[model samples]
Target: MRTIRIPYAELPANARAAVEAHTGPALKADSASEGLNSEIAVRLVSRTGEYYVKGRRASHRWAWTQRREAEVNPFIRGIAPALIARVESAGWDLLIFEAVDGHHADYRPGSPDLPKVVDVIRRLGQLPCPTIELRHAEQRLERYVDRPEDVAYFAGDTLLHTDWNNTNVLVAGDRALVVDWGWATKGAPWLDAAFWVIWLIASGHEPASAEQWAAQVPAWQGATVEGIDAFAVANAHMWDEIGGHDPDSWTARMVDAARRWRDHRKA
Candidate 1:
């Protein structure tokens, strides 16, 4: 479910003060059209310039997500919007970012943007996994693996975004900037390419065509068929639980796409 957005004025006085202390008084505050996990998704116009502000009460589950984004932003520099500042006050946690002058990435077949997306994925896979503690993909995929031993297949030290929905990527100039690092994981190098397959399928590619695109990435080429199969099965099951069999929901459709990919590989 989407978090309910709140107006900048509606935030507690201390929270607003914390922000103004950094950006000078806000000249304008407009609700942002993007972002689903933040309660405060607004673009604030300060004397300095434009900034995207995101926040939620510290007690909310997504509050942890805010912290993760803040922790990982600096490390993901070239692929993410610059982290301008971070603040906490009035029991709310927040992240302020340099707003990107780009739109969500286009993943449709034949779009010129597709090559940039692949390049970003390839570049991200090359960075050694940061030393900070990250949720291991094996642990995250545990419940869905058909065989208990298959969980080990996801283990690796590569840094992975894990979620590849087009909304999390922005196409800017000649590059695709990856945004929203909350679900970042340290896992198999092939994991990011695997996640992108479902997104390509959702964007109108057949399962085989999506895999063909994924194969262009070196990491995907290195992945064992058995390991990739397990990842697909786990992801399909995970979304099934999230969407609860709702056929019309995007999550449910992704669940089907993941299954189709798994079946295609089996064939």
Candidate 2:
């Protein structure tokens, strides 16, 4: 659900007071509209330092998503932004994070950001999945998978950031810092790289070119052909189902992009 944008001024005085209690005085709050995970995504400048804050009403159905992000943040410390503060008050939940100085990554072919993104994903693969309950990629794709046996390919103990939407990746200095862990999963090491493959294709790459880029990761290179094929087919089904309902042009484009990649794998 697209939330009505809540400017800092619109928050209840109590909510504003809660922010001040943690961060001194709020000098400025600028709305940062990059992701769908939160209704109040704002950058706040205080006497202490700068912060990024996101929150939603406790009653909102998707508020659990923000709660999930908070639960998963500490485990993936190096891979994402640091969670600085959290507030629970009067039917609202809020998270404050140390702001990173970076911009959204450019995923187009030959962009310098691609290599950094791959490097981040590579390091992510090396970290053992944290000892917390997380959804498996298999469970995530169960409704979409064409073959039940293929689920085995995604069963492993590596952490997965299932969403690679450009906004969720920030390229800062020499690092590509991934953000928003609401959809984080624990799955096979290669599965995360496979997620990036579809995103690379969405960013104006042909399937072959996207595959070439994904091959930079050793886990992806080692992925069985069957494993990658299973993921592609599942993604095609997921995107197709998504597009069939909304049928917006961007969704339509993504559906075709995923289908084109799946067909290439079959061929």
Candidate 3:
């Protein structure tokens, strides 16, 4: 569910002051419209510099995502926006990031951004999971798996950016950078590529075509056929629950996409 957005100007004076300490006097605070999380999402411009700031009430159920993003920033430097500061003040948790000038990636068939995104996935596969707090892939998906023991196929040490929607990826120059580390997971090296397959399917790729794209990632070759099939079945259940069986929603579309992949794997 989307949080009720709070305007930057309406933030408590103390909280604004805390943010200004790093940004200097805020000349402008442009609220972002794209993200689902973060009640407070904005681009701030000051005489000193520009930044992307996002936050939630410190007591909000999902506030832990703020801390998670901050903790993982250092480990994912070049592939993501740099974290400038983490501010906790007046009952809010805020994270400031270096402003990135880019557009959300295009995932349509034959889009050039596809290769850039695939390249980033390749680099991410080579990155070692850091020793910070991160959810295990199996633990996160256990409730949705076809069988209780199927979760073991997802266990591994690779740092996985489990969310693959276009909004979470930004393209600039010759590169595509991923954002929103809130769902970062420690999982099998090939799982991230597997995750990308559903999004590709949602964006209009056939199951076979989407698998072809996922195959571009070196780690995709390491995926066991059984593991991939298990993931497809588990993800379909997960999306079904998340989308609440609503046929009009993106989650519903993802459910359709996941089921297609699951059936394709079986075939």
User: Quick one: how many clashes does candidate 1 have?
Assistant: 0
Lowest summed lDDT over 10 consecutive residues: which window, candidate 3? 242-251
Candidate 1 lDDT over residue span 1-267, tens digit each: 778888888999999889878877999989877767678888899888888888889999767778888888878888789988889999999888987788788889898888998999999998877777688999999999889999888998899998888988999899999988888998889889999999999888999899888988899987898898888888878877777745657666787787787778778
**Clash counts for the predictions, in order:** 0, 0, 0
Model 2 TM-score on a 0 to 1 scale? 0.95
TM-score of each: 0.95, 0.95, 0.97
Alpha-carbon RMSD, each predicted model: 1.4, 1.5, 1.1
Ranking by TM-score: 3, 1, 2
Q: Model 2, range 1-267, lDDT digits (tens) per residue?
A: 346767877888888788778887899999987675577888999999999888999898877777778888888787899998788776778898889999999999889999998999898889877777678888998888888998888888888897888889999999988888877898889888888888888889999999988899878977898889989999999999888777877678888889999999999
- Ranking 2 against 3 by TM-score, winner: 3
TM-score of 1: 0.95
- How well does candidate 2 score on lDDT at residue 49? 90
Assess candidate 3 and give its TM-score to the true structure. Answer: 0.97
Residue pairs whose backbone atoms clash in candidate 2: none
Kindly give the stretch of ten consecutive residues in candidate 1 with the minimal lDDT sum: 244-253
Q: Which number leads on lDDT?
A: 3
Cα RMSD for predicted model 3: 1.1
Q: Candidate 2: minimum summed lDDT over ten consecutive residues — where?
A: 1-10
